[model samples]
Target: MQAAGPGSNTARPRNAAACVQVRLDDLIAQRIAARSLVLAASRKVSAAQAGVKASRFRGRGVDYVESRGYQPGDDIRSMDWRVTARSGRPHTKVFQEERERSVLLVIDHAASMRFGTRVCFKSVQAARAAALIAWSAIRGGDRVGALGFGSGVTGEVRPAGGPRGVLHCLRALADWDTLARVERESGPAPLSQALERARRLARPGSLVVLLTDGFSSDAAAEAPLARLAGHGDVRLLLMTDALELAAPPRGRYAVALGGVRRWLEFDAAAADTQWTDAFRHRRELLLQQARRLGVAHIAVDTRDDLSRCLAPLGLALATRRSYV
Candidate 1:
């Protein structure tokens, strides 16, 4: 077969070919290297002119205030052993509530995110969005962390403050984005599993952002998402592709999976009506459920510019800094 020219529409062999990967340097350039990019994006947050509700109950505190005699309702875990021994009375350590909010980026690198026909793959776009949010969060004096799920639950990064936390989260994002391009044959970890893990990682008043294609039919995640939203802020960045919603041109096409190449006969006229309807139904159902569950849903397409696409969400986030 003749080689695919500079502009061929055929899907290339993902396994045999060196898939275009997201480089660490490039991510750094977009984030730390280009400090102004992050600063500019952050500046827009204040312009939103929205006030974030302060957290109601103190979740966790950073600085210790003072030691006092233990009250009947005081938590035993907060006992000051030394003070109790010295004073011959039970004493409890008092800590001031931490002002910093924790932001967790639950990024999905499932196989579905690996394909894109426009600007970049969904996986890469997800990474960019995560990076932008991480920077914004850290700049706002909030802690940043991540729970990544690719072929399976890849890993989690505990929340931390300042540049260190943002760097750690971005590193994990880049790593997972590269791994997704490898084309693993194993089934992807259910989106529900990731949500469950997020439920555990997030504390009350925390901000949780879920980045995915939003094509899953798994209803199991509904409860967890609602639970998380109940105690913390939950936002969804639904990654989508223009082609996914509709059939491609009616013609024969070469589809590549792993190292094998196969021919797929694409005829919109002969396409199964039920399958098309199912796709539309699933998409609508996912959005409807997200709204019903009281989570902010933003549709992010592969063609979208990361910074521009995320600007409006920044405003929503501005009002979400503090949660009950």
Candidate 2:
């Protein structure tokens, strides 16, 4: 799947009445369901050698607190030259370990995401997924932020703690959804651009979650995705629709393309094979990329229950291990 062209019909799925768009109140209500969700590192401890020191679960401290007299075990790299010269004593910068982890959500609202043949549009499902993740993160005492990109427009909410952070992200998601629904003239920005922006906004130890249909992404996304994954955990939530995975029952269907009515024939076996193969190729490309970067990838179909679709994510977040 690629970005929808100009004047393309943004048709709703057969069951479109269920959830065509996301509401702020619905997103906020996810907090209640998120109470049972866990987004923190697991408490289970692995065996370690008696003489070996255990590494920290999170990354090294990056926020400076104050300078103090250097201790024998202090890292030399943290030495404060100015303080050492003024006091005639070696001093080192002290840093506080961040107790709260940062989670950045990169959501895609491209035109391709606006079509679905199930419970909701891909964009709507992505918003719900983002909301659930945000609520779960906040529940775990972590900071939540979001970056929404579509139709050449980008919106960002800086990482913040508590309900304020979740609310800000929810609003951005809602606004992006509305824009994607109304704007059909311009194509969506490439996925690489959004990933690049996320790289700049993310902190070293942040967990970056990308919610996209994987249609806007291509070979161009490789660099920024790898760079983002280099310093933090990157998770891909690939949104898909049932029709995209398989051809409809053998028949001739009338469809609208670029605001023009057209007839499509899917009776031929070769056409079905081609349709399936196209989606398969896209999925395999993304999966291979995630494998190379050692990141986690989860596929969520439009018809899938959000709770069940996100079960793997909970496990992934709870452990340091990567999954595909």
Candidate 3:
């Protein structure tokens, strides 16, 4: 009576539940109350641009500000041909810079995030950093939205410009991990889906804060990232694990699937160049791209308190008058 019972079907429920976003709204709210540094927690914004917003970075919207007589040293490119035709004088029309903007955060949650050494996993650090940014954005009077990505799931929240909306997003991001365990069986949604959705939803001149491990294998993770380059102002913060960059010393392991031998390796030093080089090199280039995109490049270790990273991002927007 040795009938092979049910052929290990455990993966069914897990896979089926992959995309369901379980709301950890309550837990996230509590964490925000405890861990958040925002002073006026209950404050709401009145003017459309009251709270912290990204448009400030846009630096005054483009407009026909004024005309100046063309100087001999003026580049030909600055010459206002239309103005020249309008008036019988060589003049250069000055255009106002874009000042208003929204910031959209696209967060990644691949299974790889679960692996970390210091304080938490990459996912935990990512969520924490994201929540801070969201709160700061709300304070800046900038609209904010989020897209959570990983093993085929995308959790979305519409952009909100006031305190209430910011609170809502903070709660969602804070409890994201618990929610993922309950609602998602697969890992996070795919990167492509999250970025694609952000691209479509974000307005022109918006700032996109992409929080990821830069773990994409698709040709240097550049092609997928390039997809967002044209959308608006982009900022990339690569959330990394200590082990991925600087592993522990001298461990030997073999990967196995039943009888199939996958990989076997042994290293004397924890920080083996051969093994960790890929992540290191990627980090450098990740920052380089951010530089090129005029985006902020941040490297965060999941093991440390996220505040180390978040505090600076907050500082970048901490100016009181700047908020106005």
Clashes of each: 0, 0, 27
Q: What is the TM-score of candidate 2?
A: 0.76
Model 3, 173-267: lDDT tens digits are 64565555445444335455566678777776566788888664233345545666665556677887656776546766565654797754556
Tens-digit lDDT track for model 2 on 216-287?
777778899999888778999999887888888899988888789999899899999998888878667767
Write the residue-wise lDDT of candidate 1 on 1-324 in tens digits: 112223221122233122234545445544542233232112211111112444454444556878999888777888999999999999988775555678899988777777666555667667777777777777767788999886654789999988888888888877777666664638767767788999999988788989988665367778888899898888899887666666767788897765799987766565746446655775575577688987888888766756666666776765654442
TM-score leader: 2
Cα error of candidate 1 at position 68, Å: 20
RMSD of 2: 8.6
Pick by lDDT: 1 or 3, better one: 1
Worst 10 residues of 1 by lDDT: 41-50
Off by over 4 Å in 2: 1-18, 41-97, 321-324
Q: How does residue 275 of candidate 1 score in lDDT?
A: 41
lDDT per model vs. reference: 0.69, 0.77, 0.57
